[model samples]
Target chain A: MIYLTLFWTFAKVGLFTIGGGYAMIPLIQQQLIERHGWVTPEQFTDFVGIAESTPGPFAINIATFAGIHVAEQHGLSPLLGSVCSTGGVVLPSLVIILLIAGAFHYAMRHWAVRAALEGAKPVVVGLIGSAAFTLLGHTLLPAGEPFHWAAAGFAVALFALTHWVRIGAVSLILLGGALGLVLRCFGVSL
Target chain B: MGAGAEGQVSLGRRLWALTLTFGKFGGITFGGGYAIVALLEEELVRKKGWLTQDELFNIITIGESTPGPIAVNTATFVGYRLAGVLGGVVATAALVFPAWLVIVVVSGFYLAFRENTWVAAALAGIRVAAIVLIARAFLRMGQGVPRTAVNAAACALAFALVALLGCNALWVVVGGLLFGVLWHGVLPRLRGRRAEGGAR
Candidate 1:
């Protein structure tokens, strides 16, 4: 039953979300939070935090965490629950994408469809923009300064480094980690 | 599959195009999806002519819903658009390679090297930069958003549901879709009838 639910939600997200992963956030959250109740608002908040804090895909991380939680709660055995939930969410995307991989070349060229997409483009931008501000509201300008200066600096440097210096993604992460170690070595606690 | 690449540009040529497309997107694409989308427009549509504007638009819409990053979806869409099945496969694999490699390598050695003070400071700095990057993307996106009352309301509802209230994203989207369809379609038509009746 839960598997079916996961598939349904992801399918809608996968089928309708035309812009890609980041665009699915509000949609995914709505499915998981409101309809399914797989996670609570606070847990959703925490997951968003961890997703941002860690590396790799944010949506995947959420799927993993949510799957694990659902599985454990339902007494499906830890491994099985995690696998089912995660797999359920991801499977729809894999299947539909692979199947539609080729046939799309022809059927997707209509003008009305183009206008619909043009409308969606800006909506996606708003959704993505809201995601960033949503994070800032939590991390930067909370009820108070909750501001961790070092984290802010690290993000800025990385942005500048990647932007101006043209360092690669891997390089920026490594350099940032190295900088973190240096701060800790001197007991800077950053 | 599908007789590999032949005719028009030869399968080999298409394959090469697939690789180069992802390779360049991989190397460039600074901030995230939004920035990458612009570059994708330039290279794929304007320069390469690999896809029409309508196709590109549809691809972005489909890409948004899939489990991976927007960039990944774009790559897969283009690859598929250009070279049938294998094109999508290679494009996805290549698109994921750079970021996955970066993350995997970092995760592998991070714990061991994380104790250094300079390293911590730098990571802290990077986080700030990430926020800045996100900020820039947000500002850029703002330029495109429709300033209509309906659109504004949708953004607000989304922000509240996902951000402050922490409502589920599915519900928010469903609500938005409902609002979009009803507010734009049904409401105006009903209002039009009322206005016509008043004129009568």
Candidate 2:
């Protein structure tokens, strides 16, 4: 029963949400935390923070963690829960993509399809831009607090590295983690 | 020995190759959808001869317009093209498998050490790094798009709608699709027809 719920909720999330993993954050939070009472908001936030830092899709990370937590509540092992949840979240994507792919060849050659893609491309760019802005907002602007200057500096430096130097994503993330640990040792609040 | 037997062997090889390729993609790609797309271009187009440049762009557009994460959606499309339904299934599974392991392992460590000041500090830094990575993806995608005035206006409009006006991202995408069809697809045809009539 717990597994079914876990799968169903995430399937719903995957099916309804568009854009990407970040776009699903609010919905996941609302459904899992507020609606389902699976985990506390605090726990969900932790998962989000960690998921953002991890490799792979943010949605999958959150679903895995949430699944483990829910499974623990049902007296099941975390491994079983993780599989159930991850399976649930990805199932919708797998089905949906298969259906779309089946039709992709036929639909792609149409002039209308080309035009629609042209119109949609800029919007996709804008959607990506919005995602960036959201990240900036979350990192730099904590609620009821002044802006974080250090975070801003880190962002600029990292952006420059990404834009110009062509550093790998894994290296950048590891470097940031190391910097964070060093900052902590130095008594910085981070 | 038979031709059919040889075909089966090749089909099996194709499925295995598709699984390996997308599996690697899912393992390394961070940030989210757009970053995955950028990496796919680098790997599938520039390095491998699997997809031509135009096909990559076309498939990416399809992935974006469809529901689900772009990375997973793209994997299914590519895998299906390579090896049919089973290929698609294999690719999607292989892609998510690595991340599933990573997340589960991290969840265990996180649950154990979440209260540590050291962990908190590290996470805070990681949070900022994650944002920068996503920003990088946005910049990468932006580089591909031609910088035209109409595109600029549409971009601004989309940003405002989603960020400020709190509009759904899907509606914004739909609006862009309509704008694109009208401006690039429909309007040009109308103008061409008018010029022909004038000549007559």
Candidate 3:
């Protein structure tokens, strides 16, 4: 039952993950965090960080991690859970792509298909904006806790740096970890 | 079943080759889908001569516009084009395998050591960085959308509903698709019909 739930939940996430991997954030937050309470906001944030830092596609990494976490929480096998969730997420893509591959040219040229995608573009941006806003709030001010000045400062610095300098995602994440350890050396907990 | 330039290769050998190639891709690509795009262009298009540049671009367009992750879509498309249905399945599984294994190991460690003070502090910083990345993506993606009243409204409405009112995002996405069909598809045709009547 737990495996089935994980598969279904991630399948929905996969189905809605249009545009790219970042688009999955809002959906996962809704389904995993709000709907199932499988992981806390903090853990979800961690999952995003870990997913981004890890190799391979972001969608697969996050799904596998969430599946394992949920299964372990339920005293089930983490490996099977990961398989189910990961398979669930990939199944939609496999089926859809195969169906469309033969008729690839025509499918892309279809008017309704094009229009729907065109319309969904801005909404996807909005959804990504919402994810950023929610994560920013959670990071800067935890529930029932005082504002985290160190984190706020890091966020501002990192944001500015990204705008000014072209830093890749992996490097930025590594820099963040290094900075965190540096701060810890000074007895300052971020 | 036999098609494409590599038709001379045996079926079993070709499937194994797809597994190895996609497995290498899955293990190396960092960040997200776009990175994999560059890699595929370099390897399949330029190096292996498996796909032409035009085909790669078309695949990218289809990948982005379709539902689900772009990397997976690309993998499936390329896989099927090269081999068949079985090839598509094998390629996608190979692509996902390394990623799944890495995460499974990482998750175990993450859960075990997450409470350590050092790990907690590091995670705190990483969390902030992750938010920054997401915000950056929002800005970058927003710039791609054409500036229009309806679009602006859609963006703002989706944000408010999800971020403020705590509405379900899936429904919001569905609503966005419907709005697209209505505004871009049906509305234009209706306007054309009215204009034609006025001319008559």
Candidate 4:
């Protein structure tokens, strides 16, 4: 039963999560945490932390791990569990690719098609910008206080280090984590 | 027509070519889409000249708004633009097939070595890298923001509404849609009538 649910949910997520892992955060949060009750907010937060720390795309990793939770609850193996949910999320994008590939070549030379698409682009940009803002707003603040001043300060420093100092991102995350650890050790209440 | 300077290739051949192109990108390209933007812009736009910068930017934006992989969507759009449906299929398959394969392989090994200290250290390094990638995107988006006062205001408002107020993305998207249409379309129409009346 849970496997079935995992399959369907992931399939839905896979179909829609078009702009990559980050874009899927809202939907993933909705389906997995809010709707399903598969994991609590704290557990989901841990899931996200582990997912972020892993090697693959955040979307894929989360889907895989969460699928395991759903399937295993219903007595399924982790491997099968992972595959079932992954299949669901991937199927849409796969179909989209295959379906669109068949006709796009012929449509390339169509003037009206091109014009309509061109017109669409600015609108799409606006939408994307909107979505980006939505994600930033969610992640930027610490509940009500702009996501903790220390974290905010760390974010600023990371930005400066990356852009101005030309440091790599991996370095900044480590630095932030270390900073967080130090604060935690010092009982700074971060 | 411009079949890579080769003779007219079959649909199968074209699809194969696109698959190979994006599949390679999926497997080897790291640091995600924003990092690969320069690479992609170079390979697909500058060197290949498949899309103009504006067109590429449009695809990037659309991918951001939509669900799924930005690379995958861009590949679909570009491939579709180049060759139609076949191109879209080939490109998307190429892009994701690699990620899927890599994930499986990596996961198999990773699950087995869950306690490795080096793996932990490497992950620490990777975490930092990922954060940097996100930051890079922030800067890039900052650069792309329209310089107009209205556009600027909209950005700030959008930020505060979403960030400070915990506004949902769907709402922000709705707001942007309305804002774009009004600012770019309705406002111009209103101004056009005023100019015409003044002339009269």
Candidate 5:
């Protein structure tokens, strides 16, 4: 039942999300944290970090992580949970693409289809913005904890760094970890 | 259904080739969906000639517009084009395999070492970096959308609804689709009709 639940939940995520990996964040956050209680907000943030740094698509990495985490929590087989979750997420895309590969050209020609996609575009952007805002809030201020000055300052520095110089996601993440270790040496937790 | 340049290859060989190619893509792409797009262009279009430039563009367009991650959608498309339905499945699986494996191992370690001080510190920093990355994505994606009042309104409304009101994101997305149809599709048609009638 858990496997089925995991699969179905991810399938809905895959089918409903149109914009890409980042756009999937809010829905996943809601489903996993609020609705299912499968993952904590902190763990979800960690998953996002790992997913971003790791090779492969962000969607696949996060789904697999969530699956394994959920399965482990239930004392189920982690591999099986990952299989179910990953398979569920990929199934919709496979089916939809296969079904439409032939007719996609014709379908895309329709003004309604294009219009609908165009309309979804800005909304997708908003969704990503929402995700960033939510995650930022969670990172900077957790429940029953004092404001994290070190983390906030780090975030601001990184944000400013990105604007001033070109930095890749992986590099920025590595830099953060290194900087974190340095800060720890100085007895700063964040 | 059309047999393209790769039609001459045997099914088994083609499947193997797809596994290797997409597997590499799955292993190497670090950032997100768009990174894989560039990889596909270089490997499939330029080096391997599996897809033409025009076809690649079409795939990216379709990938973005369709549901799910753009990378997975593109893999499905490229695979299906090369070898048929079976090819599509193989390519998608291959592409997903590496990412899944890495996460499984990493998550195992992540949960186990989460209590460790050093790991926790690194994670704290990584978390902040992750937020910055998301914020950067937000800005980049925002730039792509045209500067129309309706688009600006939709973006703000979506943000407020999800971030402030705690509304379900799924419904907001659906609302966006409907809003698009009404604003872009229906309004234009009605305006065209009115203009034609006035001319008559």
Candidate 6:
């Protein structure tokens, strides 16, 4: 049943999300964190970093990793769980794209579909916006947990650095890990 | 008879090649679908000559406007164009397979020591950085959104609905779809009708 839930949850996300992986972050957070208690909000952030740092599609990585983590809680093997979740997520794309390819012109010309997407854009922005705020809340306000002010400040600095300096996302993530390790070595208590 | 047999052999070979090429792209490209597109052009158009530049561009345009992630959608289309349904399935699965394997391995290590305080402390910094990266995504996405009253209202409403009101995000998305139909679809037709009446 948990495996089935994992498949359906990602399948639904894969079906509806547009604009790709970043867009799917909030939905993943919603389904995996808010809806199910698979991982805490803070852990979800870590998973996001992991997903971006690793290769492949953003959503698929999240689905695969999150699926493995959640499935392990039920004493399931990570391998089978990952296959089920990844299969569920990719299934929609494989099926839907094939349908569109079959009737490419007609699908493209449909006005209601276009209008729905136009509507979805702003909503996606809001969803992403909410995700940003949610991440900030988790970082800044980890209730009953020690707030690592220094590390949090460093994160802000990195944000400014990346925006102004044009570093790639993968490099930035690597830099974050390196800095984290260095901070730990120096007894920074991050 | 020889020519027909030779053609069949090449089709099988092309499907295998398609699997390898898309699998490599899926394994390596880090950023997003657009990253895959640039690499696809280099490999399929410039290097392999599997597709012409114009054909790639048309596929890209279709891929972008479609619902699925651009990378997967493009793979499906290219594979289908090259062979058929079987080719499309093979290409899509190959593209996703490598990453799925990698994630499974990484997830094992992560879950094993998830409760370790040392790991948590070390990850604190990355967690902070992750927040920033997400913020960057938000700002980047915001730039593309049209600065219209309807859009702005929708953005604010959606934020409040999900973040403040704790409403289900899915419902917000559904509302946006309906709102879009009313705003972009129905409203325009109504205005045009009103304009025709005024002309009369």
Best by DockQ: 2
Q: Which ten contiguous residues of candidate 4 chain B have the minimum total lDDT?
A: B122-131
Please give, for residues A1-190, the per-residue lDDT of candidate 4 as tens digits.
7778888888788776655566676788899878987778876776565555454345656677676666666777866777777667755665665455455457647644454344334433343344444434444553666455644455556656666775433344455556655555555433
For residues B1-200, could you state the per-residue lDDT of candidate 3 as single tens digits?
A: 22455778877987898899899878766554655665565467646787765466456656766778888999999888887888889989999999998898778686555457786666666656656766776765667688999999999998899789977565676777778778998899899999999999
Off by over 4 Å in 6: A1-89, A100-105, B1-99, B102-112, B115-122
Q: Global lDDT of each model?
A: 0.55, 0.76, 0.79, 0.57, 0.81, 0.72
What is residue A86's positional error in candidate 5, in angstroms?
3.9
The alpha-carbon lDDT assigned to residue B3 of candidate 1 equals 30
lDDT of 3 by residue, A119-168 (tens): 77777677667877876787778899999897888889998997899776
The order by descending lDDT is 5, 3, 2, 6, 4, 1
Candidate no. 3 TM-score: 0.64
User: Which segments of model 5 are wrong by more than 4 Å?
Assistant: A1-85, A100-102, B1-95, B103-111
TM agreement with the true structure for every prediction: 0.55, 0.81, 0.64, 0.61, 0.66, 0.61
* Per-residue lDDT of candidate 1, residues A81-169 (tens digit): 44454444444555567666555545447443334444454455555556566655554555655666655555555656656774433
Interface RMSD of each candidate, angstroms, one decimal: 6.2, 3.0, 5.6, 6.3, 5.2, 6.5
Estimate the Cα RMSD of every predicted model relative to the unseen true structure.
8.5, 4.6, 7.3, 7.0, 6.7, 8.6
Q: Is candidate 3 or candidate 4 better by TM-score?
A: 3
Winner by lDDT: 5
Model 4, span B1-200: residue lDDT tens: 24464345666776777777677666444433543444355466546566666656555644544556555567777777666766776776676555555445555454445455544444433333334444454445445555566666665675566545756444554456556556656666789999999999
Model 1 misplacement above 4 A: A1-92, A98-119, A137-145, A149-190, B1-14, B17-60, B66-71, B99-110, B113-122, B145-147, B174-200
TM-score ranking, best first: 2, 5, 3, 4, 6, 1
Clashing pairs in 2: A119-B180
lDDT of 1 by residue, B116-152 (tens): 4454455454454444445554554555555777666
* Candidate 4 A-chain TM-score: 0.60
lDDT of 5 by residue, B78-104 (tens): 988888899899999999999998887
- What is candidate 6's local distance difference test score? 0.72
